[model samples]
Target: MSRLEENILRGLNLIGYNGPLLQKTQLPVAIEGGPKNVEYTQLVNFLTNEIRTLLAIDEEVNAVTSPEDSVAFVMEITSFLKELNCPYTALTDGLVSDRLQNVSDRLLLLDYLITELMGARILQEKKPEKKIELKLQETPEGADMRLILQTLRFPKPPPNISITTLFQKLCPTIPIVLNKAGADIVGEGIFKGFLSEKQWEILGGIQKDLYHEYKIREGNVIDTIGRYHTIFSDRTKGKNELFEKIYHDKRKLLKVEPEIDMADLIAARTDLAIIEKTSNSSVRKNTRSQLQKVIIGQVPDRGGRTSEIAPPSPRNAPMATTVLWWRKRRIYTWGREYGWRSSIQRWL
Candidate 1:
């Protein structure tokens, strides 16, 4: 393909457009004052020239010297122009008014962006370039003269890293794995509307930096909980003050009976209400007796302030009733001791 066609294909690739370009579709190209339907190759050819002339881009040199550069230039221009009114555009005059508005609309953002794309080395060809360092080579035969092309290598961008690769860097010897979807979710900071900027930064740092097997400690757990909405620390050290407020609110809620569920109780009568009625004295008496048993049974629970336990039984403590067997020996020993004491007291 010619340089123009090659550059056009490259542009298509860069934009991720898989649609047909070679087909003779209504491309809508150059007309009397502007653009309309034209052949695919013709459309691109016209577009290439119009962009070059309009943007003052030198297609012969630094701007579009190579197909790769041409593609990058074309892609950037197309994307930028798609937002503005074009000179040879087939779009309606109304669209032109809405987008381009006038002639100056063509230069919308081309000024600064053109300069950035011009010398972008990553967009250059991947193949090594040949540069001649010396005109002659020192050979076995005194000096051998030859045209030289030495391969000059430039560093390429690193390949995309996956979560597995990141995990390997973070924990080399461990068998732990991270949930890719969860990692992405947490990294995005959109889920639960909770994760903080610092939390996302810390997570991204772990992906890039080598880290040992780590756990969330008190100090850092607070940071995690503060930054992340999901990973909660019940005992956060106040980094997540909002959650701490929530924790307190939840504790307060536990003490409050649900008002919504109790709404139906407006029509309900209490046992005390029924017991106080004069004609329902039998039920009242039974209820009183039952209430006494319930109160007695609940004594071990200390009125529900603490957990329940079996009430202590007197029958369970056999040693409390067993006595007097050792009293006879105690009395005999006391008598013998007192016999000596009586004689000693008389001398005193």
Candidate 2:
């Protein structure tokens, strides 16, 4: 029997399962590196740990000489493996091999040794767990995993319980695809299952900022959004007129209007002008004070309306008088030299 088949038979016997050997799951045993190097490394680590546990069981099996003591050893191994849910369980068929059937009487030391040897040989030959020394050999011709992961983390949500739960589901199931053929080999589609708007923005920003060899693959919306956010995000929030202009443009596109128009300089001055014009017009001094309060955002009811003089028509308004009072305050002061200054001052 092949080494793999031998191990399967032994594992079945030790687990106290009686079954004909059917077939094993077709997991690729080849260790030649490919795009799945990261996954390969992780699996190798897992398998190495499994082998170590099995070796410990083998030592325990050797210490017992009596058949009854051996059975106890086998039971210990079985319980340990059951907890691990190791691949050995999935490899067995239902046929009860004599080596396996006899395991019920005493621990199957011979079979366990054979199985461990096969596992060790496979592990030794396919040493995927060897720590790889990665260095930036050159400016990469394509995507850098380190940089990509770094940039992609932005624009993603501020992680909380919801994200933690979702990531747990992703890490075990998905094969991480490394960029090789080109940097752009990494596409946004790879992240589609977990990408959010925030993450997209972050990744996109990185792509733009790095401008390193790679571009995110075409047709990947996640990457596209990330790129867009990088290109267009407003990082500044204070007194930015350019941002205000851009904001206004978007509002126009989206048909949104602000609750208050801070940009309406003319309107603000118009209100101020009303208070000024009404102040100079023949009206009760107290009434003008109340009107000024209303113009400045405090409203109050004044008694019956006086026969208020009409405000000058915009066209016929005295040219000099039309100037803002503050601007012409000094020039207007010249008129104060006339008795109107003293008379108006006393009118207060």
Best by lDDT: 2
List the candidate 1 regions with Cα displacement exceeding 4 Å: 18-20, 23-34, 39-348
lDDT score, candidate 2, position 113:
37
Model 2, span 121-192: residue lDDT tens:
576677667688988664542244335445444233343636466456545533443332443443233222
Q: What TM-score number comes out for model 1?
A: 0.16
Alpha-carbon local distance difference test for all models: 0.39, 0.42
TM-scores, one per candidate: 0.16, 0.18
**TM-score, predicted candidate 2 vs. hidden true structure:** 0.18
lDDT of 1 by residue, 131-234 (tens): 86877656732221111101111133235855466445544322223252354332322223344789767655654332222222333654544465534334
- For model 2, what is the error of residue 44's alpha carbon versus the real structure, in angstroms, after optimal superposition? 24
Best by TM-score: 2
